[model samples]
Target: MNKILIIGAQGMLGQELLKIFPQAVGWDREEIDITDEKQVKQKIIDFKPTIIINAAAYNAVDACEQAAEFELAKKINGCALGYLADVCLTLNATLVHYSTNYVFAGDKKDGYQESEPPNPVNKYGQSKLLGEREILRRSNLKYYLIRTSKLFGAKGKSTMAKENFFAKMLILSTKQIELRVVDDELSNFTYAPDLAQATNILWQESHASGIYHLVNANPRTWYEGARALFDILGKKVKLIPVAADEFSRPAKRPKYGTLLNTKFPKLRDYEEALEEYLKDRN
Candidate 1:
């Protein structure tokens, strides 16, 4: 059995990973601040884990646009990976890191492949891309970079500044009679549990050190996804489709950020995953 160390264990994905790998050691933000280089190095040295899964990330997309936040994002999302990778190098541990679909420009009609060139449109994507590069460039440790799309799961212990899209929509449904969602932005939706299962499979079966696209099958606009959720919950609301420009946001988003999984078996459909999540939440 591989000794596993899960960083950011309080977040949604991280929490799911803890459940999936119960014997693994878990470190939330309160336990170890990833940006603190000395702490990261010291923890890994003490744990001496055979596998280090970094589910921690600075994912505040809009807030990441500010100069101070940009630097913070770089530290947490970009520079910290180099530190982790360095420790992994010394310990001879395999590092598993999560990335986002925002790495791509989202201009490609057929969705992004692992081979596609990354041209990030926002600071968040740039930071994640930087992290990926740092892991590859700074260390010789075996690594797996898994890129996922829109994620939703039961809330965890982490103090996330923003809620997942599904939770946001559910909240909006109660407070407002009409909801407006961006129709221009299209991407695949990923359930955190499915992602956790896939991560385990990739680790045990593939064991190859490279980039892989892991997400729920099928792509849909935010509007379509929200509509499906409303239907499933038996909530009656008028959902209006609006362009991305109508709702102003701090950061630029990819118009089409869908990812294609050419490496692993496709997970369940987005509708099925959403249904399961709703049931679990209720």
Candidate 2:
């Protein structure tokens, strides 16, 4: 008899989560603004959900570097979690939040473990770190902090939704004969559907709530991933591997943000997941 509440249910991951838990109540930005502490508390209190899953996030990495956007990111990605955690404690409900591997400085070339310290190098990462701290600060609060990297799946049907890497690459391939992709930064790509299904498994199995890294196996660069996609589609696009510095941006990304899964079983390879996604897209 667990009543579940899904915040930010309109996004890509959130959409998959809704499909996985059809019986669960969902609230997107239109329905609820997580930044509004009072409103969030009131809404959750009224609903009296046994579990609160926060699928919302300020994921615009470059945009978050701007002062105004940084403040907004802080409120949504950071401060909002404090209120959510507070409400979870009050109602004795479990809070499941998604975090990013960006929380780490990406200094570890091999990968990061669940027990490693977080040292974010960018504003967006800093903001997500803030949310993690907010939840962890409350020792008594029942929560699950899932840290994942580059996610790819069906695009969300929301105006606020941002396109995933695979989708962007596909569109670019159709438009251009050649594409210049970054060769540096290495991280695991996660499939939204697989991650969603794993979330349900974690909940049903009653896994001890802590930090978990759920992502597809095998770490690779963006350039490599793009090449794989073109090969899969049999598209004749010349993918030129270039340094990350070639593309100037407001935010600095991690060089190696691969999140290693030590707790749960490893997921499918990103290439396999990507192939499935492309087939679905077609």
Best by lDDT: 2
Worst 10 residues of 2 by lDDT: 153-162
Against the hidden true structure, what lDDT does model 1 obtain? 0.92
lDDT of 1 by residue, 43-141 (tens): 788989999999999988899999999999999999999999998899998899999999999898789988888999999999999999998785466
Residue 221 displacement in candidate 2 (angstroms): 0.5
TM-score of each: 0.97, 0.98
Give me the displacement of residue 150 in model 2, in angstroms: 0.6
Cα TM-score of candidate 2: 0.98
Off by over 4 Å in 1: none
